[model samples]
Target: MADITAPELKQRLQAGETPTIIDVRETWENEESRIDGSQNIPLGSLPDKLDELEELKDQEIIVHCKSGGRSASAKAFLTQQGFTNVRNLLGGMQGYQQS
Candidate 1:
């Protein structure tokens, strides 16, 4: 899976382009902090949640978790599911915070 650094993602979002951003963190972790406009779908539930994101399969989808691990998994899963443009958020929210 390709990676989008926090800073790069930040810039795209700030420009107001609507990239599909999925947050794969737990509910509690997301409740604490998250990138605005990202959808919350825990990593464990992603397989079941694909239907909800079908419209995004052909679009650029950015998956993120606390520090990139879960997002990387999500990216691979999405790609296998026929999502051609899935990208993992590098360093996840931790890197976003630093950026």
Candidate 2:
């Protein structure tokens, strides 16, 4: 899936589309600022949480972090684990805040 820009994500949220968004930053980072409704699942804990997310394997899942690096890794990892539609949030939280 193509990565989603912060503006696009904001638009979707405004339109009342409940996209499945995953914040891959650490708990403290997520607590600092976050897109409302996005799930906080730090990248390091993803493997252990796979079972909880199994139902969403074929669904669209957006992942983001403080910057873009960790979420990019999260996207790659999820895709490798049989997730068919995984997207990274471009520029991550920084971009989202800027937008």
Candidate 3:
């Protein structure tokens, strides 16, 4: 699937669509700023979170990071692990803030 642009995501959120959103930045980065309602699961810890996220395997999941790099990796990893609808937020938080 194509990655979601920050402006597109902002519109969805404004429309009240509640897709499962994950922030793949570090704990401190997440604390500094985040999309409301997004779950914080640092990229380094995603392997350990498989069990907790198993039930959401088929659900749409949006992942973002400081500058899109980490979240892209997260999306790739999740897709490989059988998460059918994982998408990386393009440009990540930096883009989101600009949007």
Candidate 4:
């Protein structure tokens, strides 16, 4: 899976290149703070949510969580599941907020 830094993502967003942003964070954590327009599918629920993401398999998908750990796992899972374009947000939301 490709790794994207939070600043690069922010620049892309600012440039109006809106790739699908998937927040694999838990519901409570999502409520605390999240990037606007991101889809919240908790990490544990991702397997069941494959249908929801089917159309996005060929699109650029940027996965993120509280930190980078969960996002890395999510990226690995997506790759194993045959997702063609997946990326992990380095440092996750913490990095995004910092940027």
Each candidate's TM vs. the true structure? 0.95, 0.98, 0.97, 0.95
Give lDDT tens digits, candidate 2, residues 27-81: 9999899999999999999999999999999999999998899999999999999
Candidate 4 residue-wise lDDT, 1-99, digit = tens = 568998999999889887899999999999999998799999999999998888888889999998999989899998888899999999999999998
- Weakest lDDT window of 10 consecutive positions for candidate 3: 1-10
How much does candidate 1 score in TM-score?
0.95
Query: What's the ranking of the predictions by lDDT, best on top?
Result: 2, 3, 4, 1
How many angstroms is residue 32 displaced in model 2 relative to the true structure, after the best TM-score fit?
A: 0.6
Q: Which one wins by TM-score: 2 or 3?
A: 2
**Taking the tens digit of each residue's C-alpha lDDT, what string does model 1 give over 36-89?**
998999999999998988888788999999999998999999999999899899
* 10 residues in a row with least lDDT, candidate 4: 1-10
Q: Candidate 1 or 3, higher lDDT? A: 3
Q: What is the lDDT of residue 88 in candidate 1?
A: 92
Off by over 4 Å in 4: none
Model 1, runs deviating above 4 Å: none
Tell me how candidate 3 scores on lDDT.
Answer: 0.95
